[model samples]
Target: MSDTAPKQRPQYRNISVPQILSYRLPLAAKASILHRVSGALLFLCLPLVILPLFALSVSSPESFASLRSYVDNPFCKLIVLALIWGYMHHFCAGIRYLCLDLQMGNDKHSAKKSATAVFAVSLVLTAIFGLKLFGVW
Candidate 1:
């Protein structure tokens, strides 16, 4: 004579949009998100900003000088810096993804380490390029 009862399972709630700000995502997730963001940014900027600037710069000597003058502004420099960062992050994250696709760093710890490496390497590369862009010796 034994009584049997169904065990209750814990319910999981979906986080609301506002709750996302407080949510602590794992490093790999954060890196993946940023990878998508950087890719999108590069895609958007390629035609809108980069192509026009590039065409202007290479069109003529006067246009090249004009482009140089425009880029001499601190605001433009910051925008270029942002673009550099986007490219750097995208490149680093792309490599990380390639490694993932090859089944490298598939474990949790390795994935976390690779994600951290992506961020660190991207930032470091961006910093180096930023310094060059800023004419820092």
Candidate 2:
């Protein structure tokens, strides 16, 4: 038998809070986390922001005009833009997850590609809607 010793495997350890900030997550993991965040944002805003605005807008002509003006402010526009991004990202990621459930793109390479595609498509869609919202024509 040879005298050489077998190589030891690297030890795996739990990441600490400080290390977490600097730790690099894989693209698919990042996308999955963001998907959860966006879903939460949508769920919370539906009750807090969207429902209130819809109720006010449909209440009366004056309320509708006020709502329109409120939405026209640059600050409000930015918030709307954020909501647009959240909605788009959540929708794209949801579809990706559905495909995953169906066993599509189940491999590592395809998973990464789909994650990248989700980001790209969501951002592109958000940009298009943002341009319209800002009256960019």
Candidate 3:
């Protein structure tokens, strides 16, 4: 007869580490955030925000002239210019994400490169559109 109970075994425990935030995240992550934000801006610019533009287009010469006088003001021009930037930025960011979906420029390095390119293109397009708007081009 054994003097004591059968031998006992030791238990082991599992451990996990918490995720930390850093300067680096994936390109897809950055692009995803930008896309949603830009979409929101573009959405808000619809309806009443675009009414001024419509008025300028369809009203008679005198009415159109009034609309122009208003928009041509520095403050009004600045606001419209910002809206133009929002539209172009959103559009370009959407395309950048599409390229990622196609598995193009998916690498970390190439992704950063394309992201910068997206903003540059957006800025250029916004400038050109603003010029066209005020008859500067």
Candidate 4:
């Protein structure tokens, strides 16, 4: 065989980055992402909001009364509602993850259904708890 110069492949410097808005991710991926977000929210809120309020509530009778009154604030109510949602979503998604880890819902259809169920259960539970929090029950 005659040795000649090897052909070099052309290197095109154009790199195309796909637009995020045009990318459609599956429901299960969305649920998984939300699970992480909810967990983070719960973890951050525990020390910043809940613990301080809990400590104040148990400090004395006056403090408890003050805390009770504080809960009546619309802003505080909204924060509590958000916290409730975080807890519910985290709890439901965690259960879903546990089931997944156990090899349940491993199939595509079952995985989608389980993700949907996690969303529904968490939202429904949050709604019920929200109603009670708002004194509608």
Best by lDDT: 2
Given candidate 4, what's the lDDT at residue 77?
94
The C-alpha stretches of model 2 lying farther than 4 A from their native spots are 1-14
Question: How does each model score on lDDT?
Answer: 0.94, 0.96, 0.78, 0.93
Summarize candidate 2's per-residue lDDT along 2-32 as a digit string, tens digits: 6697877956597778877887998999999
Best TM-score goes to which candidate?
1
Show model 1 residue runs off by greater than 4 Å: 1-14
Q: Give the winner by TM-score: 1 or 4.
A: 1
- Which is the winner by TM-score between candidate 2 and candidate 3? 2
Per residue, candidate 3 scores C-alpha lDDT tens digits across 1-137 of: 58697787945364334323433666546656766787887687776578657866687888878888888788888888888888888889888888888999888888888888877898899889989877786
- Can you rank all candidates by lDDT, best first? 2, 1, 4, 3
Worst 10 residues of 1 by lDDT: 1-10
Better of 3 and 4 by TM-score: 4
Please write out the lDDT profile of model 4 over residues 1-137, one tens digit for every residue: 35696877966475456555556988899999999999999899899998999899999999999899989998999999999999999999999999999999999999999999999999999999999999997
Ranked by TM-score from best down, the candidates are 1, 2, 4, 3
TM-score to native of every candidate shown: 0.88, 0.88, 0.67, 0.84
Clashing pairs in 3: none
